[model samples]
Target chain A: AQTVTQSQPEMSVQEAETVTLSCTYDTSESDYYLFWYKQPPSRQMILVIRQEAYKQQNATENRFSVNFQKAAKSFSLKISDSQLGDAAMYFCAYRSPLRDDKIIFGKGTRLHILP
Target chain B: GAGVSQSPSNKVTEKGKDVELRCDPISGHTALYWYRQRLGQGLEFLIYFQGNSAPDKSGLPSDRFSAERTGESVSTLTIQRTQQEDSAVYLCASSSSQGSANSPLHFGNGTRLTVT
Candidate 1:
């Protein structure tokens, strides 16, 4: 069984600053994927970024990037130059490379942007 | 639909009643997924459909919950004899292909279900 863990329950960052949300997971499979999703008040889950387990290089999407440490099974998201729109619930997810693509999610960290 | 569309953005049902939530995935998408999000909680995987493969119901919390997908298009999740604990937001998502390390799910605005 694969399980994702988000240690931070809530986080806040000043506008134009940076913040990092920590995430860790436990999985037996060597091939898999890690993801960060943001859910606004509208209730739509938006893909923030993704990292492939095999890729040693971390994933980056504009202001959103991930520190993917495969050996330690830690995948943390870094948000640089935060904006008010960044206020949302951020979730870290895990997906297996095998047949069943069910995503295992961690309890999200609510991010608040202090203007 | 242009994106994943879930019907009945909000549903209120009584305990012991049955409810059905619908999800219309994007055209040509081969994968569909159902997830539950309780208040102040993470998204819980409920079921998954990939092409013609047998659906994965491993995440379903109980047998009272069942889901069906017609071909590779629309899907419906049914909860029979719903309980208060079943109250949560039902989210639907779709991907261009089967679950892989590369495919990312596109989610729809979930349906908020309230069982009283």
Candidate 2:
């Protein structure tokens, strides 16, 4: 079984500043994929960024990026120049394509961007 | 639909009744998922189907909860004898990896099920 953990229940950052949301997972598989998802009040889950366990280069999507530590089993998401739009519930996820291809999501962190 | 579509945006049913929620995944998407999101809680996975095949179903909350997909197209989740605990938003998603192993799931707006 695999599980994802997001220890921070809530976090706040000032506008134009950067924020990082921490996440960790437990899986025996060596190769897998990790992701960050954002859900606003509209109730739509949007993909934020993704990181491949085999890729040490880390994944960056504009202001969104991930710091994936395979050995440490940690995958954290960083949002640069945070804006009001970045205020939402962020979730960390783990996916094992080789095993069952099922994606597991963490408890989630509520991010608040202050103006 | 261009994106993952779910029917009955909001459903208010009485307790002990049955409710059926529908989800239409994106075209050509073979992986479908059902999840329950309670207020202030993370997404709790209910079921997953790959091309109409569900390998593991132990994630379902109870025997009253059931889900099925039709050939990678539409999926329906049925909850019998609904309880107050079942009053939450039911979300559906579909994924396609294409040639790579890393794929992002496209999510629907979700159906908010309320059991009164």
Candidate 3:
């Protein structure tokens, strides 16, 4: 079975600063996909970024980027010049077509932006 | 409509009662997913359907939970003899294709189910 883990239950960062959220997963397949999702108070999940296992380069979208270390099975999210809107619950997810059947998600990390 | 739609934005039911939640995926999306989120928690994948492939119910917590999708359109999740623990936000999402590129998921606002 494939499972994702987000060690940090909650995180705080000052506005205009940078913060990194850690994520690790256990999967036997080599070809897969990873994603980071942001869930606001509205309970709407917005995709932040995604990385493919076959690609060595990490994925970046605007202020959000991922540090994907396939060997370590670690995929972390980095937010640069964070804003108040970035404060939300972030979830890490894993998916594969050849291995597991459904997308697996971590417990999620609640991000708090401090002024 | 333009995005994934989940009906009955909020549903409150008594324990041991059966409840049904509906999901309408994007018009041309080939994949649909159902997830359950408890308070302050992450998504718990419940079921997945892709085109004409057999649905994956491995993530379902128990036999009491079941879901069905007609082709690539609407889907409904049914919980029989629901328990208090079943109270949570049920989210539905869909994607045209499950890939790493620009194919990201489109999610619905979710249905808040409260079993009292």
Best-matching candidate per TM-score: 2
Q: For candidate 3, write residues B2-116 as lDDT tens digits.
A: 8889988999999999999999999988888889999988888888788645456778899999988887799999999999999999999988774523366789999999999
True contacts kept of 2: 0.65
Candidate 2 docking category? medium
Candidate 1 per-residue C-alpha lDDT over B25-57 given as tens digits, one digit per residue, 9 for 90 to 100: 989888888999999899888888887454567
Tell me, by lDDT, which candidate is best: 2
Report the candidate with higher TM-score, 1 versus 3. Answer: 1
- When 2 and 3 are scored with TM-score, the better candidate is 2
Question: After superposing candidate 2, which stretches have Cα over 4 Å from the reference?
Answer: none
- 1 versus 2: better DockQ goes to: 1
| Every model's DockQ | 0.79, 0.68, 0.53
After the best TM-score superposition of candidate 2, give how far the Cα of residue B116 lies from its true spot, in angstroms: 0.8
Report the error of model 3 at residue B46, Å: 1.2
Per-residue lDDT over A77-105 for candidate 3, one digit per residue giving the tens place of the 0 to 100 score: 99999999999999998888663347788
**A8-99: candidate 2 lDDT, tens digit per residue:** 99999999999999999999988888889999999999999988888899999999988888889999999999999999999999988774
- List candidate 1 segments past 4 Å from native: none
Backbone clash pairs for candidate 1 read none
| Poorest lDDT segment (10 consecutive residues) of candidate 3 chain B | B96-105
